[model samples]
Target: MTAVTKIFHDRLQVILDNHVAEVRLDHAERHNCMDVAMIDALLEAQVWLAERVGVRAVVLLGEGESFCSGLDVAAVVSTPERIAWLLQPDATGMTPAQRLALGWRDVGGPVVAALHGHVFGAGLQMALAADIRIVHPEASLALPEIEWGLVADMGVSVSGAALRQDVIHDMMLTGRHLSGEEAVILGLASRLDEDPREGGRELAQSLALRSPRAVAAARRLRREAPAMSERECLERESGLQRNLIGGPEQREATRARLEGRRPRLA
Candidate 1:
């Protein structure tokens, strides 16, 4: 018999329980910064969750006060050779930066990111990729890459958060931080919660109870629609709806509704 691979037995604190996966950034001393190692670990976490058949929802959180402060500049500056590898064109063709920002979005299930304290630069980009972002009242978000003479190359332009043009422009230009309350009003965050981690768990529990197939379908459409032309978007929507209309999950959902009971979800 083969030994089962542990989902997370390494750097990050990962827990999969009751169909909900909790993926956290645990380096508080460095303000949860994404050093080269952390970036690779995050991508590994994404792959682990994506391959799991039992996971229904994911909760992303930082173990300490902050979500992630940004990239660990010292890591690259101290050893310039590391930067070469990060920027090197790979067989997969995706830069390390892009993988770090968008890997969570590519997962099969919905992701809820709960933010607190300083969520800056790369951190903000990662949060934008989540299916839902719940932020604490005091959490601060900013794109400070420009201040460091670096472009925000981590999927910022392609993510849905870029739709809010005015907000993006101001934050990008001034390196100013947005509070969680303002983030909600501007649509960057889904809502404000006093205790974001607990809020993330509650949301995850609620999502885990929904039809997993429908949840995945909706997430794919939300992502694909934005990258398509109007006609393509409409056609994709119809095609996806056709696939889901009479599926086992849909029938189960209908039966559950008729019986006035919770659906037997994945």
Candidate 2:
């Protein structure tokens, strides 16, 4: 495990279990606000997890009181120097912030976001990328980018397309916050729970019990389900299967099943 640095200490944390990875946004002092460092940390965390060979699922959560309160206002408002710094790109080939919000969609395994408290602006955009969003009753979600004098560049257009047009328009234009219940009713959150963390943990555990290859294939299928044609879907399925068959992980899975033992996957 890498040690959290002061620059990104409040931004993110990663814990890799046997086959499940948990990533927590930890900037409680500022409601887990998104900042340059925080964004970099998030990108790094995802990149790290994607390269790992054993993870079958990922659970994203927030530490302390909230998931995220959106961009760090202080970082933007404090001074011209700070603003410039925040706008600079990272050196690790991290995708742009907008694309970074879509990273969860590209991960091979399922991603479940456990949201609670304030989830606004960029925060909400990040959560929207997850395959499943489980929100606590007290969670509040919104898109305040328009009010902040900016167009939402953080993949909102793509992710929000999953929701009803009117719902997306309402959040973007009005900056209206939605409680967890409201989000569920509006088809934003997948489920509601009293404690998002426990709910997320249970869900991840259940998912981990499944075959890793099956979960990955299901994720790929779900991502293309909304807009892809049957022909395109079949082509994608073929490509993914070609990459998985005889691969180290796939071979281990097959061998384990035949031997009736837990697979020791790479």
Candidate 3:
């Protein structure tokens, strides 16, 4: 296990290995609650990975037992200062949760989330953003924002469309949590594992073994399959490569391979 650096004290830790990076929610003391600072750090990690070189896969996980409990109720209710900060716009001029959720789509590589314990509210949104999710057999997944007198945001509408409408409605409307087996049955999770971390790492390595170009192309296809026309999707493919080929990150990646060194960000 490589020593991942913690980007921010109030946020999480990120570890970049040969061709894989892992983002771990580090707020275990509070069940990895979604506070303003954690949201900012999550978005920053995505932006960093977007520009990263030689990275073919990413794993999203929580540092401790539970994946994430949800929004920090104390931060939202007891602390006006914290709530004010969360309401502030991010660098992309998006709300903190919006940035954190949408940023995953911008990351160039495939992301697989290793979910365990409780994954509720905004945490479920984060998990939904990943290309694949391998959840623990005992894990609980839910969307409880509606119970809090707020509509679900954080790109849930777009991403949740991938899951069955009935399943999505069941979780979103009633705030009911689904077990890993139930999630898989409902098409909410791709796989169930006894140990999500090991399963996630194995999947990441498998994905890393494939051609980076092909992986990226497949990601593009999957992301655009819903709303984009065939012609639009083809154009998107060309546009993505146009931005990547001969790019700074690609150059660094090639150089790193030849030099037998970890690729350094430009």
Measured against the true structure, the TM-scores of the candidates, in listed sequence, are 0.91, 0.80, 0.80
**Pick by TM-score: which candidate is best?**
1
The 0-to-1 C-alpha lDDT of every candidate, in the order given, reads 0.83, 0.79, 0.80
lDDT of 3 at 37: 71
The candidate, 2 or 3, that scores higher on lDDT is: 3
Query: Backbone collision count in every prediction?
Result: 0, 0, 0
Kindly report which residue pairs in candidate 3 clash with one another.
Answer: none
lDDT of 3 at 225: 73
Question: How far off is residue 157 in model 3, in Å?
Answer: 0.9
Which is better, 1 or 3, measured by TM-score? 1
Candidate closer to the true structure by lDDT (higher is better), 1 or 2: 1
Ranking by TM-score: 1, 3, 2
In the range 1-266, model 2's lDDT, one tens digit per residue, is 33222223447888777567788888889888987778778877777777877677788888989988898866657667755544556674433676558887655578899999999988899999888999997899999888878766677777777788899888888889999999999999999999998899889867876667767787867767668888988888888888888887788788888999877643
Q: Total clashes, candidate 2?
A: 0
Lowest lDDT sum, 10 consecutive residues, model 2, at 1-10
Give the C-alpha miss distance for residue 136 in model 1, angstroms. Answer: 0.9
